[model samples]
Target: MNDTDNEITTDESESTDSEAIAALTVRVVGPAGEPIEGAIVRGEGDGVEFGGETDADGTYVEEEADTSTYTIEVDHGEYEAATVEYTHDDDGEVTVELASPVAVAELSVRVVDSAGEPIAGASVDAEGRPHDAGIPLEFSGETDSEGVYRDTVYENAYAITVDHEEYHPETVEYGHDGDGGPTVSLEPIEGGVPGASRITVAVVDESGSPIEGAEVIGRGTPHEADIPLQFRGETNSNGRHPDVVYHNDYRIQADHPDYTGEIVRHTHDGPADVAVELESGPERIPVAITAIHPDTGGAIEGAAVRLVRTSGPDSVTADAETGSDGAALLEVEAGEYNVLVADDIDLTLVETEYTVAVGDDPVQTSFEAVTEPDDCVLTVEVVDGETGSPIEGARVQADVRAENIDDMGLAAGEADGNGIAEIQGWCGEWEPAIGSEGYWPADPGRLDVAGNDALTVELEPRE
Candidate 1:
């Protein structure tokens, strides 16, 4: 028996003094214990230049290997290349493990409208991605040909924002819950004008009886710009004025020749119906006020008419809203008053001082409410900074100041279930403030309408 160091006795060589040639068998397997067929198993440095690929069972055999150090190398395109070195002294078998190449994680985003229709040309932004900050915020994409965006990203928490001109934005923090990514839904900017959007006004008498044929009128309130609210047909037999109106509030005046007219403030933000009650009185002359656009000759529907007592006993104060005919009527004792007139949207109006004499004949008056049209709007949402979760009940306020249109002092609203708040949005530059309990109030900041039509207000908790 040749027991020298690094010597192997073969079956052909029975004498221990002879130099024996050793053989080696190599078996290659993958991570799952499956055979790696295409792996190249090479044995060198042993005076035996044997190189062969693994077979179906990942086994490679070298029949003749000398008693010397050998470097066994395995090369496969699909797996990491590997090599092992050892002395071959006898018929030896070794198992080589192959590993799969590392793969990069990826995520995708799809955007659609409230109607489930894919929205093209919508901008998408993502945060906490591997890319540089504001890279996606500035130019992620304007939605692809399929209205979807897919890319490799950092394996961590992410936030997505989608913006479109004619829709409210979609914003959320994201996680890879094995679904690849999220499909976000955006709400379309709904309803504006008489024939464009939807607004319902209900006219009723003191007893809650529907007043048919009662003229219905509405105009933008201070919360909105001086956009006109135009309605053509009168109330049907049901006394319900379901006309198309913008997403705004209006001072609605319902009038009937026999019954007294009533002025009511109604908000037509959503689908809720507004109710107006007309109080009937025994004796009253029609105090008619015609609010009109001097340039277009269109009767202004939502003019705010306030009669302040300029000179009288006690103080005669009465408020009325113009009807669809641009006229308002009220029963008042003959007195001197200063009629301060302004559009419901705070349009510039003339404050006329006049004297009222008790009479059956209608006292006619006319005032002009001039304004430049503005259709700007914005949407906002609040969220927690740490958890990246939506925060409900947050108060949001937008200060609107546009000359020739209207000045909305400070339109405020509370966040809803989705943490979204819709204020009378403004175009141009505006200031916004946000706050919630246990959270640091966001400092008031300027927002420009040129780029961001929607904004996310993230609140950091007070540690």
Candidate 2:
């Protein structure tokens, strides 16, 4: 009986070994039904290992006998991993369809101040290896009230930066394994002003009553400057205060520390003492200007212009220097203006007669001075068609009689490659003509002079 039992056991063991020895052939296909070569296929089973790479046709065959349910893994760049489970059988074939890997790495980030309090609305950025690997990647998210930010990233390494008002920017490095659930922490910079600016301000309450103890702050570009102002000063009981500030376009913010911060833009010139009612928050007025050059029909640059209000003794004026594009901008109250543009070479004193209505928005006005009419000069250029060369020394004539008409009974003159011929002191009507070898008799009637200034004429080729 013992001998029989040993024989049965040997048979069972041999059968198990044969099952494990079976080999598998894997074929990889992309979403488009095209073969994907160079994909790695790995399989392991029952303490046995087998692996191979797909050929040019995306086909791979592994010769191994580990049959106890083999796990096959396939890897391709930018594509998600593919896995399959199968009991190996002799001559068995398996096909793997891999999906593209998610290009973004999903991550959660949290920002806290030095005191470990959550910082809301903080900007968070993630950058690392995979990010530096020349792949198209971008990370963006804002921290919640709990100081946590959730974002997705592609597989790679990256550096992260966080920023908030009243704190310095913080940055760190991180690497991800293409899996989720990684929480990043950022340390908030302390005491440093994130951004701040200052402006002379005036305030009043809803009933036109001056509200004292009102705190004033400046936001936007001013806040980002080197010397940012966290707090300027509180409005006096009469709603007035003396404060020196840097020059900049600013968004004014007022707060009693007990009430919400109200924001408004102070674009007007000089010291601002506007009345702000508690019931009505803030008001905005757009400002703009225009510049002109009458001489060359072009716009003037660096020209200073001003808008002066026509109201009572309480008149306000806004000033601006023209830009390269010949334009200026000035914010003012909604009213009329005695507009003035500083005179220049091309601009006569009379050209300064320009005015605009400074409405709630911007206003544009052009300035050009009229001049006396004078004689007009006509210049004609003639070129040879065959050799594409200018016909120099050729005679050009005009039918209109001048004191010195040339011997050809034509007001003729020699041509210069610079084809410049001035009809000096010529007024009223005239005609034109050109003379050259192998050319038709050029007509002198084609030239016309109307007003003062210079005129240009190009003679067509004569067949």
- Highest TM-score: give the candidate number: 2
State the weakest 10-residue window (summed lDDT) of model 2: 401-410
C-alpha lDDT values of all predictions: 0.69, 0.62
Each candidate: RMSD to true structure?
29.0, 20.2
- TM-score to true structure, per model: 0.23, 0.28
Query: What's the TM for model 2?
Result: 0.28
Off by over 4 Å in 1: 1-288, 293-297, 300-306, 317-336, 340-365, 369-377, 380-431, 436-439, 445-463
* Model 1 Cα lDDT, one tens digit per residue, 283-371: 54557767777567777887767665556456766778788887766655455566655565542433334344545566787766544
lDDT of 2 by residue, 191-258 (tens): 45432232446677666777788887655354342354333667887786555454445566777633
Worst 10 residues of 1 by lDDT: 130-139
Q: After superposition, how far is residue 15 of candidate 1 from its true place, in Å?
A: 99
Clashes of each: 4, 29
lDDT agreement of model 2 with the native: 0.62
Model 1 TM: 0.23
